[model samples]
Target: MRRTRAATTAAITLSLLAATACGGGSANGDGGSNSAPKELTYWASNQGPDIAADEATLAPELKKFEERTGIKVKLEVIPWPDLLGRILAATASGQGPDVLNIGNTWSASLQATGALLPWDGRNFDAIGGKDRFVASAIGSSGATGQDPAAVPLYSMSYALYYNKKMFREAGIEKPPATWDEMVTVGQRLSKDGKWALGAEGSNLANNIHQVFVLAKQHGADFFDAAGKPAFDGPATVDAVKQYVDLMAKDRIIAPGNAEYAQNQSLQDFAAGKTAMVLWQSAATSFKTHGMKEGDWGVAPVPVPAGGAPGTGRNTNSMVAGINMAVFRNTDNIDGSLAFVKFMTGDEEQRLLNKAYGSIPPVKAAQTDAAFASEDLTVLRETLSTSAAPLPQVPQESQFETTVGTAVKELFADAAAGRPVTTESVKAELTKAQQQMTS
Candidate 1:
C-alpha cells in the first residue's frame, strides 16, 4: 500500500550524519550540471507480487530516465508492512530518499509531517500540469485547495469479484446490486463445503476498508465535522452487524475467515472455494493463482436498499492506491521531482500499471489496450464516478487500526460460533471510537 526509507539504529545514525554532512544541492538554475551527473535515491513500493518483479519492471524505465536527464536513480523496493515505519524514521532523521512511493490514503497523514515538497505552481508546471491527472486521484494527494504533496502514480478501486462457474451452477443469472440480494444469492450458491463469500477478516487494512464501504452504504461517515470519529452510530453498528452476520447469520462465509488475510481470501476465490470477494488490482495475481480471465466476473460492490446511486453520496469505492512524493530536503530535489514526473507520465504509467495489473493515474492512459477489458472498464468508471478518498484527518491511521481491530474481534466471535448482535457490534464501534480519542 505504501513504501519508502529506513532504520534508526546506531549504524543508521552514522549514515544520517554522513548524509547531513554531504549537504543538499541548491535549487537554482539547472539544479545540476550536465558535466557532473546527478544521482537520486528512490524508494519504490512493492507493486508486483514480489519485489524482484517490480525491480525488473522498473529497470528499463530508470535507464530511460538516466538517458534523458543524466540522473541516476537508485531504487529500493520496500515491502508494505515495513514502509511506514521506515518513512517515519527517515522523516524524523531528515535522511530520507529523494523520491518515494506512498499509499494515496497516507498522503494527508504524511503531508502533515512537512517533510514532503509541495507539487504546485512551478513544480506542477514541470510535470505537464495539475490538469494532467484524474480529478479524484489528484484530489487524493492532499487536502482540498492545497498544493498536492504527492502525485498519484497508480490508481485502484474496490469491486466485487465472483466466480462465474460457481454462479452459473447455482442458477444465479447476475451479480447482486444490493446487499440483500447478495445474501439470497449467496445462500443458494454456498454448499458442498464451499462458501459464497470469503473475507480477509484478520487483515487490518482489509477489515477497515470493508467497514468503510459498508458504513458508507448505510450513510455513516467514520468522522463527523470537526474530525472526531462518529463510529458508534446506528448506521455504523448495522454495517458491522451485517458484515459479521455473513458468517453468523447468513452462513455464507468460511468460519476460518477470522484468521484469513487478503491473500488467503483471494486464493479461496481463485480456487473456487468461495464464490465471491471484494478485491482491487488483483487480475494478475488471480491469473498467477491459476485462474483464467473469463473464469471470474467483476461488478461494483453492492449497496443496501435505499442506498446512494452509482454516482451519488457514499456510493464510491475508496481510492486504495499509491502515490509518489519528493522529499523536501533532497540534494537532488529537481532530479527527484523529475523522476517522479517521469514515473507518473503517460507512457511510463501505461507500462508500469500494465505490468502491475493496475490503472494508470493519468486520465488518457486509461484508454490503453491493457485497460480496455470489461473488468478494468468497471474499475475506471468507479474511479471517475464513485471513488472517494479515505477520511482526511491527522488521526486517519489510528482510526483505521482501531476500527479494524474491532472488526477482527467481531470475526473472532463469529469464527467461534458466538452470536454477534447489533448491540455487540455497537459496543465494538464504541470501544473503537473511544480509542480514537486516546
Candidate 2:
C-alpha cells in the first residue's frame, strides 16, 4: 500500500481503542440479507497516481461487471491518508461499503475488530477455493492460525528505481547491491545540485516500511515472539539510525525531503532532480508523471554490507499489497461475494494488475506475459525470496502509528542539523514502546 501524507492518527487511535474495548459488535444488525442486491458499494484504495486516474481505470471494468452480473458497484476511490481512518470509523459505526480494499498489513488488526467477514471454508469455496492465491500473498491476509479476514487483490514489493541516464553520467555500471556500495555511489552522485536518493520523510507508513526492512537486515524485530514491542532494542536502534543517516550523516537525501509528507520525492525523481528512489510497484505512477518506459530500471533494495537477500535477517522488503474485504454486516453479502469473485478472476487479475503495474496474487494470472517485464521480475523474486510480513497481531496498527511517528520526528531533527546519535534514536524508540504498553 502506497502512502502520500500523514493520516489522522489521533482519531484512528481513539476509534480503534473504542472498537477493541467493545469487542467489535455489528451496528447494523445480527446478520446480512439472504438475497443478493442489485447494487453494492465499494471503497477502493488509491492504486493509480491519484483518485481520478484510478476512477478512469476501474470505471470501464466495473461497468462490464454490471453488464454481466446486473450488480452496479458504486465506486469511491479513497486516498491512502484517509483510507484507514474511514475504515476504522465505518467498522465502529457499521456504515462502511459492502466491499473495501485494505492494506494487507492491516488484516490482523482489522480482523480483531470482528467486523469483517472471515474467509472460512464456505467463503473460500465461494471464491474458487483458498488454493487459487499465492502463498506469500496469503501469509499477510490475517493472523496466524486463523481464517483470513480478507483475500489478496494486488501483490507488491519494494525495489530500488534508478535513473538510467543519471547512472551513465555518473559512470556507475549497475545498481548498488549493498548499503556500503549505495552510500559510496550516493556520494559520487550527490555532487552538483542533485541528490542520490529521494524519500517521503514525513509519511507515516513510508517511514515504517523503510525502517522495518532496515531492522530486518540488522537482525532485529520490533516485536518479540510474544507480540510485545521491542522498539528500543540495540539492533532496532541501529536500524533506525542507519535509515535517518541517509539524510543526516551520509548527506545523500535532500534536507527539503524531511518536510515532504506527500509524494514530492517521486516527483523529484521524475523531474531528474534525484538519482534514485525506493518505491513499491511504481511503474504506472512513473508513466503518469511523464517518465518514459526506458528512463528507469528496477533492482532489489540494498541489503546490509555483508548480508545476502533471503528470508529472516536478510529480508529486503515487507510483504506489501492490498487485500479485498467484505463488511460482515453489509446488507448485500451475496452481491459483495460475486464482486470479489469477479475481481479475483484470472481475466480481471491480468487486466487490472497490468494497468496498475502490480503483480497478480492469483496463481494462474501471475504467469501472464504482461507481468514478465524486468521491473516485475525483480519484485516477484523479492516477494518470493526476501520479503517478510509485518507482525500479524492486533496491536500492529498501533505499532505503525507510534513507531512511524517517532521516525518522522527523528528525520525532522536530522533536517534541522541536530545530532541523530544512537542514544537519541533509542530514546525516541523507547518512547514509542512506552505508548504501546501504557
Candidate 3:
C-alpha cells in the first residue's frame, strides 16, 4: 500500500540508531508531565486521488470530531512516497504528530523502533475493544505474539478489474479465474494498440504486491519460516518469471508500462487503453477518473491452474490496508486516543471507507449496505478468505525495497527486448537477497 525508496534500508537503520540514542521521553521533550493539548496534530496518509482531495474529504469529518469532543485535530495528508521516510525521521527526532497512518505491512518494522504506542489491553479498551475490528484486518497490525503497534483503519484486497466492453468485443464471457485463463483471455483482448493488461511495473510497492501473490501461488514466500531472505528459491524464481512474462512472452502489457510508477495503469484502464487491471479496492479510483459503475466488473485475482483460492499456496492477495498508530512519546495521549476512537467509531468508519472506496476494518461498519455492492463484496470475500499478510518481520521494509527494485529492473529489461528467463530472474533475486545483508 506504500512505496519504498532505494535508500530505505539505510534511512531506517539510521533512524533506529537515533531513537536508541534519544532514549524515552515525551514528544515535547518534557519529563512525562505535560498536560493534554487542546489540539492534536494528525498525520494522515493520502487516501484519495491527491493530497488536496484527501484534505477536502476529511475537513468536514474533522470538524464533526471537533464539535463532538471539543478537541481540535490539525491534519496533514502526507503522500505515499514521503510518508514512510517522514515517519522514520519523526521517530528519530521524537518530533512527530500525536497519531499517524501507517501501511499495515510496516507495523512490525516500525514497532521495532520502540517509538510507537503499543495497543495493549488498556489501549484497545480505550478504543472500544480489539474485537470490533475484523480478524483479517488485525492480522497485519503487527508481528506475531506481540502487542499490535497500531489499530486497523482501512481494509483492502487485490481483485482483477476488467472492462466489460472489451470482454464483450473480444467474445470473452468471463474474467479469468486461473493464470492460464488470464493469458488466454488477455491474448484475445490485446489488439489495435490496446493492451489486455495494465501494470505499474516501475512502482516498487505495486511490483512487490503482484510478485508476492504470484510467489504464494507458486508455493513460495520471499522469506522463509525463520524470517530469512529466500528470494531466489526455485518457486520464487518461477513466480517472478511468470509475472515478467506477462509483458515479455505473453505480450499482454505494453512496453511503455515498464515506466509507469504512478497510477497510469489505472488511468489507462479508465480510458479504455487497457482491458484489465489488478488493483486493491479500485472502485473509488475508477469513479474519480470518470469511469462509470457499469463499465467494468470485478473478480478474484487469478490463481494457479489447479489451485483453489484459499490460504497458503492458493492465496490471491496480501492483506492490504492502513493502520492508525499513536506515538509513544506524545504529549497528549488522551486526546490522541480520543481521536483514534472517533476515527474508528462505527459512523466515521462507514463514512470514511465509503468516501475512499475502501472496506472498513470495523466489523459493524463493514456490514453497512453502502459496502454491499458487487465490487466491495468481492474485495471483502478476498480479504477474509484468500489474502495472506506479507512477512511481519523487522526487516520487511528492506525486503520491499531490495526485491521490488529487482523486479522493477527486470521489467525494464523486458521492455528493452531482453529475455526475462528463469536464470536471469534468479540472478536479479540473488542480487536483491545479497543487498539485504550488505
The candidate that achieves the highest lDDT relative to the unseen native structure: 2
Q: Where does candidate 1 stray beyond 4 Å?
A: 1-37, 306-309, 312-316
Task: Score candidate 2 by lDDT.
Answer: 0.88
Off by over 4 Å in 2: 1-31, 34-36
TM-score of 3: 0.94
| lDDT tens readout by residue for model 3, 1-438 | 011223132236733544562344555432232266677888999888778889999999999989988888889898776677778767766667788999999898888877788888888999999999998788898989999989999988999999999999988999999999999999988899999999987788788899999999888899988988899999999999999999999999999999997578989999999999999988888999989989999999999888778998889999999999987777777888888999999999999999988999999997789999999999999988999999998888778778888999999999999989989999999999998776
Per residue, candidate 1 scores C-alpha lDDT tens digits across 1-438 of 122334642112222342442223245422222222388888988777668878988898999999999898888998765576677677666667778998887777666666677776788888888888888888788766667779999889988999999999988999987888889998998899999998988878778778787777777778998777899999889878888898888988988989986478888888889999988888887887899979999988887766643654457488778899877767666677678788878889898888888898898788888898878888888877776678867566567668888999999999998889988899999998887665
Report lDDT (Cα) of residue 373, candidate 3: 95
Kindly list the per-residue Cα lDDT of model 2 for residues 140-164, writing each as its tens digit. Answer: 9999999998999999999999999
- What is the full ranking by lDDT, best candidate first? 2, 3, 1
The lDDT values for all models are 0.78, 0.88, 0.86
| Each model's backbone clash number | 1, 0, 0
Give the total clashing residue pairs for model 1.
Answer: 1
> Which candidate would rank higher by lDDT, 1 or 2?
2
Pairing residues by index, what is the TM-score of model 2? Answer: 0.94
